[model samples]
Target: MLYQSFREYAQGAAKIGIGLGVISILARWVTGITIFASPEALVKYGIFGGIGYALMGAIALMAFGWLGKRVRKEFGDGLTIGDFFQFKLHRVGYWMMIAILLITSIEGLFTQGMAAGVLVNILFGIPISIGMLCFFLFCVVYVGFGGIVLIQRLAFVQVICMFAAAILIPLYFFIAKGVENVYQGIRLYHPYLLVLNNHEGLFFMCTGLFIGFGQVFVDQATWQRLYMLEGKKIVPTFLLSGLIWATVPLAFSSLIMVVIFTGSFNNIYSLLFDLIRKIDTIFLLVLFVLCSFGAVTSAFGAGLHSMISLIAGNVYPLLKPDANERQKMRMGYMLAIAIGVLSIVLTFFFTPTLLELLFFFGIIYAALIVPLLFIVFSKGKVDNFIPLCALIGLVAGYTSRYKLGNLDAVWVSMMVSSLLVIVHWGSKFIKKQLGNH
Candidate 1:
């Protein structure tokens, strides 16, 4: 009896742990763009740039735990972060925050849609519009009908497939070609990639970190995970996921490097196509397919799920004000389908190169980072004008990019907003003191 009970307990614990781990990987780490974007950075900027890309994502995931703990403490049993914000913030402030959230979330889905279109083009040689529709259909069915429980279940399979590919594919290549050959090949074909301290490269790296922190902290999918996991499980899950997630990008980036070590390509997409052509081994092709699909689906699923939470908790509630859980869930499902379809349509026409796309949005993400950190970490309510400061800084930063360049634009924007908010608050404090006197 004792032995049986112990076995049963262990099995149950394993079930929950595995479920949470899958969710961590799928909900936070995996994304359609992550697969395409990280390797693209590697090729454009160098291997170090790829490493920077991966580190940005991992760092963001680890830091989110701090936000998670505070959120749960402030609003226990909440299904979404918006729920907490809606309750804590007054009407004007709540709407302001919600508007920002919706814009960011939509941007995220738009990116995901682009990745899905690209993946479909690669996998099936189909029109991007049709492929995008298929992507939308899958997300709608899984997230809408399956709910959180099914989403979590699918995540486990996705995580397992991702790890297997990240591990085995790299291992096979290193073993077959030998590490020295790959290294020498990289040196011969792309010598600049080895130079880590290049001035332009280092500058981008620092700015990338700031943009990374903002994107991770403000992302709704990540916030949803914060409440779903056991409180103690939150930090460790993020830390472990970060460590494991680091390996995927490094491995995939290196895989691309191995392909290019022999010759040049037209662009990132060309490199991907070339890699596909060069790999005649059926097993390796299957592995690549699984890896690619896993990355895209994980990202799409997380984005869809979080989008639902925002609509259900933030937008719908404002209109209804007295919705029950079932009504909220129904609205959530409807919103997911509508947004998914819209993103798919938008993806059909997006033409920017991957790095350019990231840089374009990186300004907005970086501008919001400090303001959010202030909101979460500050002792009391922040300066009301701080949100507007971020908006102004974002516009200013991107507009000045031609004059200052991308890296400098980020630094300047962050500094300018910080100063403006501080000055704004100081004047308010001075007036309050004069009134008291």
Candidate 2:
């Protein structure tokens, strides 16, 4: 169906049921980056990487159920995350977050585009630039024009394919290869993977929890999804989605182990390509490609659509005071194309490993988690310092990178921001005591 109003374009008038609601949330979170990055994590941190990565996201989703409950209680209606942000934030904080949201949204799309570029290059012998361009354009057409109705409809199908691949491929690999053969191969080549006491892996799980919380809290797609569900279903839907979503990463991680123990691979992408090339089963190979493609497009589409909805609903009216719903919807379509172009361009020039990309974004996610928690849970108008805490902590985190490793820098950002939040609350209490005197 053709989308006329911006709300219809964004969320299909918030009429989604618990079943599709779960699928939509799954599509948003089980993204291209998650699929590729989980395997990469397994390669680096061994068994801990696979399970820890999956567990981190599962916990984040479950935790968001709590935040979602409180947020709906306070202000139950909204089109985008920006609607909630505008209601809670003063002018300065509102604009600061809007700017950050735009940046992070673009970063999200670029990362997905990178995954698509790599996949197409491996499978079809397409140039990375051209493949990414096609990916962006396809998303723009589907998400920009088809709107949330189409997104949800496609999400239902895409989700089934992804789960099928994650389950069937791993089950097939393990059964055919035999558990003993794979286990011996790993023990022979990478025995460290079996170590029960992996210090770095433990650290990754701990620090990764912070990143996961912040990411889910601040994510535009997730917040938009909050307003899309029934009031009673909010907590349970989010919690269940997290539990089921956890399986994809762990399964994908095991799927990669099918071949990686055979020989040394230079990087995750090469290892992924090798896995694909080694799979002699034709139907399984087809399923893998579809899974990869579905993951990338669904993720990119979600990010692209959320941003367009945010701008059309929250930002455009400020620029065009007299604009109507259709006009804003039109602007949303334009924004989708523009953002898609920008994402493809950036992905073309700025390429990083999936692990590197995650750590880099971790600073932003970590610093914002507490401040956003403040925005939702606190009473009265939130202080301007709430948003400033994120900005300041982000700078401190990235700046400290010279002296610290990537994960440590991310923790530094979270701590600094949390400290600022504490000071803000402490000062408020002190002023109340002074007034009593």
Candidate 3:
């Protein structure tokens, strides 16, 4: 955990092994938000809704593996997504992206904070503010100040506990309750969940790809894993991580099912209450609580640490080229505390549902996916105008949001950005052909 250089602090003392990397990523992705949101998705759009949601994230992570191999090959010594974008983009484009990234990063911490707040309140009867204060302080003190070195070490232990809970609790539930009885109960009460040919579910799955692509692509936390591993391990580590992560939602969704099968619930909130009640055995109950809490802790820590890394490794250098390593590290510690406090305040005030948060951010994710893909796949530095497409699409999408609804607005944003990119490339090709003639 000891490190002198800012690089060492932001990344690690050296590269990590595949096993550590995969577990660290699992810790990073399977957040309390993921635990809460998965079950909610199952309730909203039926069984496929939950599966599609998991598929979106899994596909994104797996595809990131394929794309990241190319990224690391060309840009091997990167520290954060900020570094990569700065290298690829002009000053304007880079700053624009930094703004977008900053928003998404905060939004990410917000979700975790909200989930953690609710979790503690339910489990321990703690007030939301007190719970959030403890959550934020812990993350900043340990993961934030300790940096990647401590994060990786702690991630190994946390991920192990998560997988243990994910496996054992569900197995116990199914075994005790009987799978056949559970299935019969579900069919008798919530029959739509059993239906396969759900058109809304299929549409949701398809649109989810755009959000997933941009989310994984622009994620600073995921990018940290890319550079923190052995060069040869990049693809397989991420590929394996995605496969492992996909199982998390399934396990969580099943945990909720244990409650759902007993009788009808009023809504997702009541279902959560019932799920908590259903954890009858003390061992199973402790396992479930720890798993959910660990999910929040790991995700929050990864996010807070990565944001600190971005500021220390990239932003500080951009602003003050003369800053020494000690100064950069100091700034990072301060920034971590600041960011954690900001997340606490925001999470306390913003009371949107997880789905609302997803759709709200979906505009940004959808808009950026295509342009970012083009930027990565292209040779050398490209136009700053490429990044502008995201801005235009974002404005267009938000404007249409009230009229078109949040979900459809996401599609509009993606479509607008995709068309712009096509035109940009098409015009470039035409100009090149004319010059050749």
Candidate 4:
């Protein structure tokens, strides 16, 4: 019955055709992070950095299809990445992989929690803690009870609202200020943003690309979407999603330009408030509200649901391998509520600016990219120590951040980890050759 329900959801989605699917995909991928973080990037880095941040995510998502195809082909029927890793890897390796996944999941909560807090503070003048609680509660209930069916149903609505906002918000601003005037304002007030090729900016883009690849490639939420679609639609769904997803960040970044061009703001939330006040049209304000809500909720819902699937399918089953389907479902629902509560609690205590949080998470993700790619693409079992090398890389890169500086950390981390992986494997290869002789 559960399988039948899943089949109906997947196929029934086709009745709306690819357009709706594209919108749903857009909503799922283009979350509050893009809405809040891109502008935050604009405030801190420059206009180019803002656009780079957006581009990185879109590109990451576009390339994830390759990873998805590989994963599905290897372990076609598995429900989660953790499940696939458990079957393919040794106990030590599997635990190591799950540890990384769990860390990423925690970071995912942190990221979304920050974005939710910022949005709530922006839209309604609500306290971040109160707003976060409401956001988490909504996500937990919708995802836990409705499962993927309702998540996707609301994702379609979310995406439509997001795209409408993306197009209309910028269009309204561009019309008001005129493109030439907006450009002049950016150039005059925030000239640093206008310059694209600063050395720090260039390195940021390169590292961002690597980090982007890892994020989309390894993310469980994205992986869940892979199997949820028809095999034929799988590639196109991701591809079109990427294309449509690109416009959103660009639009949001440009909207921030409208904000920054007008005057300086102290923080991202303040910039959002400024934008809200500056807009003349009531329709646009409502659109902003819908877009903000949709972006936050789609991401929150996907995270909540995907995390539930991970815990139930991957973690719970380990202790109770013989558990029935209903038992698994019950565990999943409970876990969904637990994660939501944890996210709300976490939001209250820790608050970092959205871009800082993104880069902080980016370092860990960047470290994992080399090892994960090696594992996925290599023939047969790649060396287990590769992931361990990544852990070392994250430490080394971060240690260097204060000593060497921010831009340099990404490079140091990537190079150190990649080189260590080679050295670690080389020693093992040489030892094995001697033994064979």
| Overall lDDT per candidate, in order of appearance | 0.72, 0.86, 0.84, 0.74
Cα lDDT of candidate 4 equals 0.74
Candidate 1 has an lDDT of: 0.72
> Model 3, 1-437: lDDT tens per residue?
56777788778777987888898888889898788888888887888878988998899999999889888877887889988888788899888888888788888887888888878877778976679888888887787457777777777777878888889989998999999999998999888988899887777778777888888888899999888889888888999989999998988888887898867878676677678888888987887888888889888888988888888877887889999888887787787677677878876677776767887898999999888988888888869888899988888899999998887888999999889999999999999999999
Angstrom error at residue 249, model 4: 0.8
TM-score for model 2?
A: 0.97
Collision pairs in model 3:
none
State model 3's lDDT. 0.84
- Give the TM-score comparing model 3 with the true structure, all chains together: 0.96
- Once fitted onto the true fold, the runs of candidate 2 whose alpha carbons sit more than 4 angstroms away are none
Rank ordering of all candidates by TM-score, starting from the highest? 2, 3, 4, 1
TM-score against truth, every candidate: 0.88, 0.97, 0.96, 0.90
Candidate topping TM-score: 2
Query: Please, what are the lDDT tens digits per residue for candidate 2 over residues 134-251?
Result: 8888888888677788778878878988988988888888999898899888998888777779999888888888888888888899988888988889899989999999998998
TM-score of 4: 0.90
Which scores better on TM-score, 1 or 3? 3
Ranking by lDDT: 2, 3, 4, 1
